[model samples]
Target: MPDFTTDHTEPAADRVERFQAAASTAFAPLLVRAHDGPPFHATIRAQATGGLLVSDIRTSPVTVNRPAGRISSSDNDVYKVALQLSGTMGVAQDGRREVMRPGDLAVYDTTRPYALEHFAAPDGEIRTVVIACPRHSFAAGPDALREVVATPVPATRGVTGLVAAFFTGLADELPNVDASGTHLADALVDLISLTFATPPRPDPSALTARMIAYCEANLSDPTLSPRTVARAHHISVRYAHRLFAETDRSLASWIRSRRLDRIRRDLENPLLAHRTVAAIAARWGLYDAPHVSRLFRATYGVSPTTYRRAHSGGF
Candidate 1:
């Protein structure tokens, strides 16, 4: 995150231009104005973590453009995960178009071109959150994930809903988070990975159920150590270890494996062209660059950068 200012008084054209200039280093920009209609207003707040960026945007009716030329020439691939808080909107991508209603989630890639047209309610308001990250961050193979890339992925239930909720909540809380907030970011990534990996289901075992739920709930608290979890459950640390041991895994091992899975998925995404392999790894909580490289190669049988380059068509 960086210092930012808000100006609601400027004319639409000037405001849009300013915003475009500010975001151009990170993304290709477009802002459209509504004419002969209700008042159109927009507020944008953007923050970055590694190559992943989260943007909270509320705007009035306007058309969004992702031109074909820009798509062909841009160095970085963009994925816009849009959550509609209110009103109705439409997105056109790769010759396919879909309209999104309230409580719906949709993803679109910038490597290819797309267009979005939004309509405000009669009361003249449209509110939404748009999280724009490098497409590779989502942790799915490009070919397997592309079919659903720009289409709406409903977050109305289960793991998807939980992950979506966590992201939206973080956007509202990021202003209050500081350097110590790294834990929160880590948890968000984990929850997102779990959400994308597992179908909606209840845990079958009590110990596993409790552990997973607690982990999801306290991902932001760095002090959420194994001791803390043991204490909360009225058990000893040894017992907690035994619980995981019964599953043939340790708590630390599970977490590390989960994090690695996320990194591998992002590395294979075709839409994350602009981000380097190291950047993607760090973004998902693999802090030691060399360690990440070695572990990724050992586990996946390919280096992180090489995997990303092969799948994403990156240079």
Candidate 2:
């Protein structure tokens, strides 16, 4: 598994330099901004797995200028899916103008010409989550998907929402992945395939539910957070909180419980005999051995080591 995370706050000039340096390597630049100043207060994370590239980006107010043409330098074909995480984004593609609000998703082909303008408040910024997949990898035909590309599609419901949620959840858990990273990556591909196979509809609640399930499946990740989950679903931190609240659990507590469950399972696995209790806990994002021991005792009424010793015989 390959993971990269960058958090930066620098002067406009330095920031632009960094942005250009980063973008030039991965994405082609027609017109790079932050020229006036770095208007984008941004957190950008990108993950590549099973031929899919997912990026979670939250930016301060800024304008990205792309003239009506594809970058002549890059020949790679990518289908870009952008979900508005906060505020609004105005996108113009093939002479059609679309306004994307929170919970809305839009797709654009890297082979075409389009312009995206991210709106910001006097003191606020715009946030978005973007997933880029090879055009050939999408389950639906390129033409079939193109009809919705660059147009505002609702993600608060239906298959699109489910897909958004899956991507977000996967992003959060990418860092803690171990030998099972390949399986997780394959699962993500399957989810994306499901998303493209479903008919479009409006069901934000349904999407949130699917997202919760995805999170549950990957609870061992220490990097999981409300922000990461929300970004996956193309929503806000507050909105992600609301979804969990509906389930009667805060995000943090839910993650903790998930880690505990994984530890419990590991304790019983005779094949994992060589791995220590602390190693298992750390694999699931529990860094402090003492803390894991304490939490295990509080929840399961026994220390992890004791639990492992008792359960190991069963396997």
Q: Which candidate's lDDT is highest?
A: 2
For candidate 2, report its TM-score: 0.53
> After superposing candidate 2, which stretches have Cα over 4 Å from the reference?
1-11, 35-40, 68-70, 121-123, 177-315
Worst 10 residues of 2 by lDDT: 1-10
lDDT of 1: 0.64
Candidate 2 residue 171 C-alpha distance from true site, Å:
3.3
For model 1, how does the per-residue alpha-carbon lDDT over 1-315 read when each residue is reduced to its tens digit?
Answer: 353333667776775565555445446655354534544466667666545567666666777776765554545676667787778788877655666777667767777777888788656667667766555566655554455544555577776687678668856865654444445555655555453442333443686679868865664353555656765553435556767887867876766666678777777776765677777777665667899889888888888877777776665
Root-mean-square deviation per candidate: 22.1, 17.0
Q: How many backbone collisions does model 2 have? A: 6
Off by over 4 Å in 1: 1-9, 22-26, 31-35, 72-74, 178-315
Colliding residue pairs in candidate 2: 41-60, 156-203, 156-204, 157-203, 157-204, 168-232
Name the 10 consecutive residues with the lowest summed lDDT in model 1.
Answer: 195-204
Question: Tens digits of per-residue lDDT for model 2 on 1-315?
Answer: 122223465566566556555543454454556423444455566666656666666565555655546466455577777778778988777655667888777777777777777776345756677766677766788777655555666677677778678756755765543433556556655655555443553376797777768788666677776656765654445556766787767977877888899889988999998988888888887889998899999999988888887889943
